[model samples]
Target: MKRSLDGFPKIEVNTQRKEGKALKKEFFRKERDLLGEEAIPENAYWGVHSKRARDNFPFSKKVPPSLVKAYFAVKWACARANLEVGLLEAKIGNAILKACEEGMEGKFNEEVIVPIFQGGAGTSLNMNINEIIANRALEILGYSKGNYQKINPFDHVNLSQSTNDTFMTAVKVATLWQLDELEKEIINLQETLQQKEKEFASVLKVGRTELQDAVPITLGMEFGAFAEAIARDRWRLWKSRERIKEVNLGGTAVGTGLNAHPEYIARAIVHLNEITGLPLAKAMNLFENTQNLDVFSEVSGLLRSLAVNLRKIANDLRLLSMGPRAGISEISLPALQEGSSIMPGKVNPVMCEYIEGIAIDVMGKDQAIAFSCSSGQLELNHLGPFIAAHILEMIEELKLGINAFTEKCLRGIRANQERCNELLEKSFALATCIVPYLGHERTSELVQECLREGKNFRDFLIEQKIFSEEELKNILNPLEISRPGIPGFGKVEVKRP
Candidate 1:
């Protein structure tokens, strides 16, 4: 076997003809079955197929780092399983394990250069991983790069595995990793909203419906609703992991475990769970797992649901913090940066706007994932790469966007106490508070009367002598009106002339 001198391959210098000049360049000629004699960079660990893929899908720059690490974990587990079943040599398996361990520790991340938008049912991505790993393992064993005949990328690294099983398994693992972080971001956002809820608990405001005054509500209540919605999303996200935990790791090619030992199938999943620290299990029916990709659709639906919630929350923040002069101004968001060059002292809700845009993008990506996952043929889904890439992008975008909103906008939010009081005083919706004493008809009349005279509801009520000042104070208590479960509020004692 041709081996490196110091257990590591060094870049080789070669002469090439370029522009009729004798040019010296560093290259390595790696051969492949389909595309033979391709000149690769000498220092590159990836091989012919990876180069082809890089050239083919130049639009997508690279694969997600999480997926690359997850792929390495799958390979590491497979190597251990093969070695355990006496199918692989100890030296080769140990070297593969070392490379995978380094990969999991983020060592070879830069080498994961496969573009995410490739075809071939993820075969290109799998080959990219196999080539990088095999060449790196060859280096650790004192073998030269591209000496695959001796250290065989397919035979040694990808033994007992296929693109269908390993790639899907890695996608699931990567998604689980991303969801864990997303759940944290969701919880952080929820806690921040809850904190604001508590801070605004006593500040009363006029609630609106269809852009018209509806009833009395505390500023805390609105923020509390946002917190509750995020809390629900956090729970749903935690449960989403269970849906993807069942993997078809043992199902090769078409879910039959072809050319793979049955023992390897069973043991590989166990090792994967150990390596990934996720509660992954082999599917009860490998055929079903292999043929169907609806699990991604289901998870994407949950993410879509979350995106919808985030959009609503963001829009509410935007509307609530509309302006200091002519808008609702019930709440004020932190001034992130200068809003416009033309408008001085003006600040925009850029963080909320950013979150709104992210939510819209996530929803769109979810639609793409759902449609692509359904485009699977009989045996396998050709759109697995697209689905995986979209899902990971959604999770990452949500995580980053939620964290940014929490830190930049949510944490610094404050209630507009003066505005809340002014709007509440002018709103005739407070007539609903006295609806129990004087039925809906009389209350509506009072509301109409106050609106027609352009008089504030409190002033109108005091002018009518429906109740004395003390009685109005007791009747219009903000907490009493907005508190929950206070139905059948007996008649307020009215002292009339």
Candidate 2:
């Protein structure tokens, strides 16, 4: 033994002493009894999650922070629900609340690096939080760690609760929060598109390839379509909110509400509503809620549909803004970063590409959710953990998609007026609009003459003297012809030559 400069005792061991080996032996003996019990091994620590889960589900990356946040939200709600329902004493509720407040303030999330995939149906996750909360509460009560003497993880901290109920409740509460974020971002994107529509209302484009001055369409209509699509998604999200409200909070162990008081169920829901300020309601059938994850599946389906719609929009935007020189340049996307390494002037739709990737990720998560939901067996749904994990992931990705689309894509997108005008001027598709006014037979003759002579519609009309320049101009005006009040063949007086 030696003393350091600070006077603390230090034992300097030679190789012969084997001090490390002696310490390891002592520690192993102490931990042996703890490891004997299978339900909760005594030697377990907070950060040590199951490695097998990580190996099994390599498809999903580590669980997202949003999912962890949702976990906390659900725990808080559960504690509040327990208090409101009188499942726990007021003292225990107060202690749990104080512990939760502390837990929320602390860096407890550092322990959630474990794989979300587990054969125990999230029992490990439930225990992980339970142990953490119990330890924190013990500290709050001035008790030593691992002392079941003061606040037990099961009897006190997790009284009248089961992993089945708590996990599902957490999923709903977390999803509601995530959906709120998504709604705000989507609405912002919608508003941005609407403003663009109004700004470009009068900008017109004609059919260009046909070299026919086809009927006119304002840039506003294009942007307006984008706005309408997002608006519909917003409504769908709003409508789906109520479905998440039906939580199975009291269905402990398995939807039987066993070991729980009837009062506890009602109080839990009421308190949860108060704590979250959300309109959460008790499930009409706890058994169904636990056994059938159809609701989660349904919501996941809606999310899939949303992702598909988002991808479609992104694809259209990318196509419309394909090139400044070569492709169909109907719009100019906001150039965020350099698009190409070799092509000097190339500016790819990076935002759209990002959104497309997000959409793909969301779709993949949706499949995971569906698979997890389907894997549930009798009495209790074992896939609860995976469901929560994937759904939360979907929400986060969608949020990023909405934000990126708004900031990088929608904000930077501009109507390529010159390109649009050129394309419209060249397109012969406008021939259809004029056919309704010129009579089908005459329109056919005009189209044949233009095609045979490789001449423009205006040039051919002028050479044939089909009508005076003034009449041809009036008939070919895209804006007037495309308008609602435009006269048809019966209304317009035409002299047949």
Candidate 3:
């Protein structure tokens, strides 16, 4: 008998390629289950059940590592609860605890080769973890792989748990973890927007309604609006966290707690909160938690809102930075790459485009999450993993997308101050500002005259002496006109010539 350098008895799964050919021979240990026997790699920590799952799930890709670690966390909590209730033997439970601790650190994540998409409602995933922890615990106790006789996967590591409850619990826990990260990203972007607002606070530009100029505005105020939108999203996400913290653990196999001990079920939330360091709570009604997935759908709805806001913000930036020579080039984004292969001196708002694309992708995934949540059957939602996949994917996409958008675009954006002043000067939209001073009838007459003569409203106002230079400056101040309350309304009558 031989042992590997890692100190486990030699049960190695290896392949050697010789002269462009696959391995000619290999070795494995035989493991048996209710489905009969199967050969597994002798040194591989995962046993027959994991092997069967990986074989069955040919199309399964990588499960999110967050979900994987969260699963480990759930199991660790369960083991703790089981030990407290006298359901798990101290010697064997301590070994399982060590194994679970390693798994939480991502030590055994790669060994979980089961595919994510399958018909078992994440049973394969649960069993895969169980097998890994069991075998690793066996090695810790001076045993070889496939030594389930020393520490059985289902009997010992998985005491007082069921796939129905544990997997869904892990999903909620994992989503919460990712949500925390996403909230930080949103706050980061929101802070950047606030910085831009302060930076461009005094910048004057033409404000538009329905894509047509309506009035004057400060560029800082527009960024402030973006910040406000993100703030709302952040609030919604924070509120949504409370809903998902109520997990369905201890509701074994349909909320009946059939095989789970009463003490374990009673103490489940306490252990989970201790392990995850979050304010996790047990479900108020385990049965309702077991079958109903409306909570997840609601969270997905918020994600949909976030995506919409991001897309809207990106589009606004794209339009503001649309043209350098002939377009509404009121702002300039940092150039990160070649804009065109054929046109020289050409640049595009690719960062804005990228953010918009991610938003749309998030929206599509949000729909998938909704569909998956609503598809649950009587006593279980077989689509927990499915919903988890889409939600986790959206969180990751938004995080990276928001980071890229802020770093590559928002932070580097420069206000085209000269261009903004030029557009504001050229546009007659400022004509709306003088209504109170000139009265409606007189203001319209002057506006038509300026249009007929092809003159700017500011120029015409100055040329016609509609107000004294002091009064005109006061009436047409971009900050004064853009703010709330009537501009030049409460003041004494303007000095008109």
Reference-based lDDT, each prediction: 0.87, 0.70, 0.86
Model 2, 1-497: lDDT tens digits are 44433332333333334565543311110111233412222223341223233435556455555556555555666677677766667776677677666555545766554566665767666666666676566656655445554666677766778888877787788789888998899889889989998887767665332533545677777678888988888888889888888988888988888987777777777767766678898888888887787777878888888888788889878877877778888888877788789989777888888888999988998888888888888877788877877788888889887897888778877887888767755656556656656677888888887888887666576687765566655655545654676534443456544
Candidate 1, 240-284: lDDT as tens digits? 778799999989998999988999999999999999999999998
| Candidate 1, run of 10 with poorest lDDT | 488-497
Model 3 CA deviation exceeding 4 Å by range: 1-16, 19-25, 490-497
- lDDT winner among the candidates? 1
Clashes of 2: 16
RMSD to the hidden true structure, all candidates: 3.1, 5.8, 2.9
Instruction: Tell me which residue pairs clash in candidate 3.
Output: 11-42, 11-43, 12-43
Write down the lDDT that model 1 would get.
Answer: 0.87
Give one digit per residue, the lDDT tens place, for model 3 in 88-194.
Answer: 88988888889999999999888989877867789989999999889888888878777676789888988878999999899888889999999889999999999
lDDT, model 3, position 153: 88
TM-score of every candidate relative to the true structure: 0.94, 0.84, 0.94
